[model samples]
Target: MATTTSSYTRTGVLEVYAKQQWHKVLATLEEDHLSLCLDESYEVPPITNNGTLSDSEPSDIPESIANTKRVVRVVKQDNNGLGISIKGGKENKMPILISKIFKGMAADTTEQLYVGDAILSVNGEDLRDATHDEAVRALKRAGKVVDLE
Candidate 1:
């Protein structure tokens, strides 16, 4: 018996390759007990002649670099006085309150410190001048005990 070889076409090759690649990926994930995580906000619709439209694009860039930075002011006040407001009078303020009350003979030593203390500085740099995320990252870098007083 003789066998003849026929030339293969490339039109559907990419699709076939993609399917095979997907299968390989799934197999690898199964073997490793890994899964892909997708955001709940993502929505997919059937493809049309005009192509699918994405509500947003996923980028490989870090959020710290991609997102706009804002300043978060820490204020000192009582539970009744605590209120958070967006800068430029945007909206109502959300207050940060502490529920645990400190009780001990050493209360005198801690009396100088109070619960509504906002982080005013990190590494001696005033947070009032820094952006919200920037101040947080700076505090993390400083390795100091962040507290209110």
Candidate 2:
């Protein structure tokens, strides 16, 4: 006996199929709970100093250095996205800064999160040196919940 096979020729059919498969797998993985993990990676410019080191110096040195800092932000969807600031840095630790740009809902808190808030981890993964873009991509790929405050 011979068996016949069916094939799809529509555009993005493969993508759709893959998405369905992923959803099915995710569903099975989360059968015990409704928790979802979300993370985002973004680029943070290095600190710059333009002031002269000394007044006696004839020329002023550009204090700004070009270095890349990777920031990964994680948020739990089911928990109302309540957490500390997502911005990666030690200088600014306000939640308002993070909430200002997050595409999703923002947390309600009296204290604000700033641009320099240090990011410690995402979904239990340490993001000490991860780039902002890398973190964002990883979070999106994980398909977790996220909220900005």
Clashes of 2: 23
List residue ranges in candidate 1 displaced over 4 A: 1-113, 144-149
CA lDDT of each prediction against the hidden true structure: 0.29, 0.31
Among these predictions, the greatest lDDT belongs to 2
lDDT of 2 by residue, 7-101 (tens): 52111100012321211111112324332222223222222223323111111212341122333444445644443323323232211123133
Best by TM-score: 2
Model 2 spans with C-alpha error above 4 angstroms? 1-115, 146-149
TM-score of each: 0.23, 0.27
Query: What are the RMSDs of all candidates, in order?
Result: 21.7, 21.6
Model 1, residue 36: C-alpha shift (Å): 48
In model 1, how large is the Cα lDDT of residue 4? 21
Worst 10 residues of 2 by lDDT: 8-17
On residues 24-118, what C-alpha lDDT tens digit does candidate 1 reach at each position?
11111333353433333433332222254322222233445323222333332323222221111112122221212233312113333232223
